[model samples]
Target: MGCFAFKSKAKNQRAAASGARSPAPTSDGQKSKASSASTPTRSIQELSDERGAQRLRVFDLDELSSATNGFSRALKIGEGGFGSVYRAFFRSAGGGGGGRVVLAVKRLNQRSLQGHKQWLAEVQFLGVLEHPNLVRLVGYCAVDSETSKHRLLVYEFMPNKSLDDHLFNRAHPPLSWRLRLQIMIGAARGLDYLHEGLQEVQVIYRDFKAANVLLDADFKPKLSDFGLAREGPTEGKTHVSTAVVGTHGYAAPDYIETGHLTTKSDVWSFGVVLYEILTGRRSLERSRPAEEQKLLGWVRRHPPESQSFRSIMDPRLGGRYPAAAARQVARLADRCLVKNPKERPAMREVVEELERVLQMEPPTTTAADKDGDRRLPPAKR
Candidate 1:
């Protein structure tokens, strides 16, 4: 509930270092906007060398205070162990006459010295990274003055919030089958970039769950939350060894047991989400019957190859989705969930598989039922 709370590492050990790169003021002494690039590392010395932090804009207390009305509870958009996220607005950069800019400001608790590392990690990584599928880090604020010390991160406003919201909240309209697949493909591309995009280093997203996948106004999925992200194994190294910390039921078993993390570990988590989009169930849902409590365990009973598989699809779908495409999604999810990490398909392969499903012929729409639910014929295999 506290947003990917980490348990293994001592809170003190992760405190912010005095020497890590902190936000710098602009030349004109104005600090409203940044380069608009989205880009992480945790070690203070190591992250400082990356120099990605320099690219970000710095926000003064006044700007943050004005935007959130002195961090009012009314403007609070999200809350967790680390801090609260508030929706804020500011005058756009360049000219005083510029339009208003919508943003989300994450104001970390001052007492959470333990979480300053995570805040810095996000600043380091988001500063250098840029991608359509990765949430953009607009700016940051870090102050250690006498009165108060502030650490805040500014991000482009995600009007649609997160995939977790749309998937689990019954209040929201059910996502169409086509839109679901599209969101998955886009998220896969974001993960693929982290795994294979950087020339010198790869990012292993330690936490890959529905909640971390934020959506823009268009429902475009973008990966967020770099608090637990770690650099992938260097050349010749099999995997990075670190304390396992991720949301329960979403972590890869091998990583949980061995503290060894690889891109494949992310692949496994991605598989869990693959099933999530298909079934509209969290990785671990306890509200169902005893046999259906755990998503993976319950899904195994009805393999994609079996006739019972359709039973696991989100009932909210009302049989409107293409039957064959749905089955293929289940099959792909299984591939991502392979017990052997080495055997899991790469994110690129996962994206390709999903794309192929989208290319398949549309399911023929037949007559609507008495309730007006249109029955869709199974897609061609």
Candidate 2:
């Protein structure tokens, strides 16, 4: 999940440094082949040069330390399987005395299972790939000391944190139905860009979950955390044969069972998040009852077009959502969650369906809508 650390008023004197100037933009023919590989085998320098004019900064460890207050505990905003994230503010030396810039610095845990390899993968992919929905990598830090190695990544600070916090955290006001649809659309566009927007490379977001969807000040959704991202199947290849690596309950069943990854795997995970948006519960929650613990299983019990489907609507919405739109979303989710990978709708199709649903007006609340509130308690699972 995206974390937020407020900036301390103290001025950081550490001078920011920029990497070597990138060469002029290269033609598509000159682009490196390493990027299209299933695993990102290219180094940052290689990819950065290939990007041509898109230079990713090489951050100094001491400068990052000063920005983060020496990695103080109080500044930590969030933590995940990979490492801890700290919010920081530092003046841009390249700006020539401009105001301090905010950043989210991710410090990799030395003991974690994914260390250098995952870190490098992020640098390789995000260092060159640019999109409105993808998080911007401001810079990165790799330091070696006598005792240990320190690896860090710097990204643009997402002010609103993650979609997970807003959806499931009772502390925050519940998301309005329209707002939920807006966020989903933005996220779908991001996935679409990865799958089809790139010239020849199809980036499969291996870990597509609510936590990875970070929101900015305007509530714009941006996909973050590329540690588990991979390039999709190459020419003539049906799928990329690799070990399955993704969050539990979010990975596609086919990939989880056979270790054969494809773009369809990401579609499955997107469907899970779509359900989470409809019903404020998480994809997987062990604290609840066994039957309700798995979101997919619980949702399946309430099929679309059946009376039971109303039970899946988030009660927090208070019948303010359009019934027709909700049904359309449910049906879309059903298609996305189909058992056969071939049966699932492509992300582009999912985006178009969402756009159509967004255009529909919410149904006027009637006796039946009110009854929906009483039909099922908000899914705690």
Candidate 3:
């Protein structure tokens, strides 16, 4: 499940400050020799076959259970339509010093059809795929001889919570402008990697949204939840046939209407995320009165051309960000929301343009000092 699917303020709060790496408890947890080679370079097909054959080593449920204190309520991180995520600490088989890596364990809901597919897909995809901006696949476990129920997928824990928590939740202070810009760039880079970064062929990430983007302690964005990913036609087939499985507001209109899944579909979702970053709002909203339910539609009606940007600025930001930066973001968002996917900018172009705009951004202000006149180099040294 994507981050939006889960709604836990406490877990989100802890995650907001720290990457998902959990510290090992003081007692009761068993220690095992970390795998000598946790991940060896391998092709996707090879990994997929390996998973089927049980070549992927399984972690003892008892160890994870003990680590999480029997999935104590306090440790329950995030839960979505598919399952609840619990933070756990486990020793690496490779014997690395960072024995306590925060891991997000999704325990699948047995009755959920969508969750079942998502669980397997995540295990398969992350099991093989490796990248920095993308969450790492530590390992996974399925039903077995003794404990043959409850499907679970574990991932490298990220301290900072999902982008949604920072952008929407009020508990945390507003993220600095620099952090926000970096997150956007990191996310775009992650998407760029997914779309074209693979060695053999491209992969299309069908789902892209703020909630799907996790942040580290430094606020670097890491894209997760690839259940809807489809291999590019060059790798397997140019197209795939499956019912749409994305959040409503973020889904590409053409793909939703005609079921044509392509790299452009991901671009459209990216546009929605870009819009969210600029405006600091959910992609879709019904909280407003009935007439204002559709966010994108409302944005189109009150395009940046005709109105003050303040109408869409997040109240929390206090209009503190640069006006030029905001306008540049809004303009790029407009281009991304083009109904014709062909008209939208390519991911590479988006990355390049955002990098340029980020350059124009002023340095971030720190908390320790008053608004002083350091810019004028003193009257006399």
Worst 10 residues of 1 by lDDT: 27-36
Query: Candidates ranked by TM-score, best first?
Result: 1, 2, 3
Per-model clash counts, in order, read: 5, 0, 20
TM-score of 2: 0.83
User: How well does each candidate superpose onto the true structure, as a TM-score?
Assistant: 0.83, 0.83, 0.78
Better of 1 and 2 by lDDT: 2
Among residues 3 or more apart in sequence or in different chains, the pairs in candidate 1 whose N, CA or C atoms overlap within 3 Å are 38-129, 39-125, 39-126, 39-129, 40-125
Deviating ranges (above 4 Å) for candidate 3: 1-43, 50-57, 91-101, 145-148, 235-238, 366-381
The candidate 3 region of ten consecutive residues with least summed lDDT is: 26-35
For residue 48, model 3's alpha carbon misses the true position, in angstroms, by: 3.7
Q: What is the C-alpha lDDT of each candidate?
A: 0.74, 0.75, 0.65
Per-residue lDDT, model 2, residue 66, is 97
Say what the RMSD of model 3 is.
11.8
Please give the lDDT score for candidate 3: 0.65
Per-residue lDDT of model 1, residues 79-185, tens digit only: 86679999998987766677888899998887785577778668766766678899998777665555656778899999888889989999987776776777788
All predictions: root-mean-square deviation over Cα? 9.2, 8.6, 11.8
| lDDT (C-alpha) at residue 104 in model 1 | 97
